[model samples]
Target: MDERVTVLKKQIRAVVVAGGTDEITYQSEWLGYLPFPVDHWVEYQGKTFSGDFPFDWTLDDLASLERTGFLEKLEAYENPEDRFDRCIRYRVHIGCA
Candidate 1:
């Protein structure tokens, strides 16, 4: 397995162990199963926005989505110490992918 995938899995495990819940509405029919809430924020075109990350998505899927500039990672949300901290948040560019 890729090291990044391992790291991502660990991050997700930490968030779930910490009691994170799904709080955002499903954003895409193609992207299903978001186990964690979409609580992270990102700035784009001078506007801040939040988005959902599919819980079952793999890193390869993210890479494909990102190649189209449809997803942004919210690195600030990776802290496991924070109770609200969850898996890496992906700001999905809705309708684009």
Candidate 2:
């Protein structure tokens, strides 16, 4: 597994959660900016937020997510069969927004 990916994910999460402000909270923004689909809700920073599908994307688009390091963390685990959903969820939950 690529330790870099795991480290990056944690770094991203830390930066996001630390950006909270009185008027706007970045904790939820990550989940909304993801370039993929999601289900009913997302949970992060010890809280839960509702979610909706990003859109219906083509195979090429889905592939691009992986090609572009969008799924690097999940891929590093080397369990595609089990981590597919997790890959998407992590993308949605940790997107930089």
Candidate 3:
């Protein structure tokens, strides 16, 4: 198994439970995004916010999360026009609003 992924997953869990703020930018503004899919996804004001990980995605980490699940929702760019574009990533919405 991937140890780094495992470790990172644990760290992310801690961050989610602590209740804090973190900003994740994809093609648009998504606030309170949870890297895990079990989290709730909501839209507030003019931006989108994802609460806690949903039951299905709660146990998944970067490597373990389903590649096709919600991943397809992400915007993808070839040759990445920007820095955030080139890297394979997921957004985590932290804290409670």
Top of the candidates by lDDT? 1
lDDT of 2 by residue, 30-89 (tens): 233458533323334434432222334222333343455543323212244533333223
- For all predictions, the C-alpha RMSD in Å is 14.6, 12.3, 13.0
TM-score per candidate, chains pooled: 0.29, 0.24, 0.31
- Cα error of candidate 1 at position 55, Å: 12
* lDDT (C-alpha) at residue 61 in model 2: 38
Among all windows of ten consecutive residues in candidate 1, which has the lowest summed lDDT? 22-31
Candidate 3 TM-score over all chains jointly: 0.31
For residues 11-90, write the lDDT of model 3, one tens digit per residue. 55455455443322223222334773222222222244334433243223433532423222243343434332232334
Query: Which ranking of candidates, highest TM-score first?
Result: 3, 1, 2
Cα lDDT of model 2 overall?
0.35
Residue-by-residue lDDT tens digits, candidate 1, 1-97: 3455444434433343444431111121122237744343322333332223334554465455456655555442334454443344455444442
Please report, as a residue range, the 10-residue window in candidate 3 with the lowest summed lDDT: 37-46
Clashes of 3: 9
RMSD of 3: 13.0
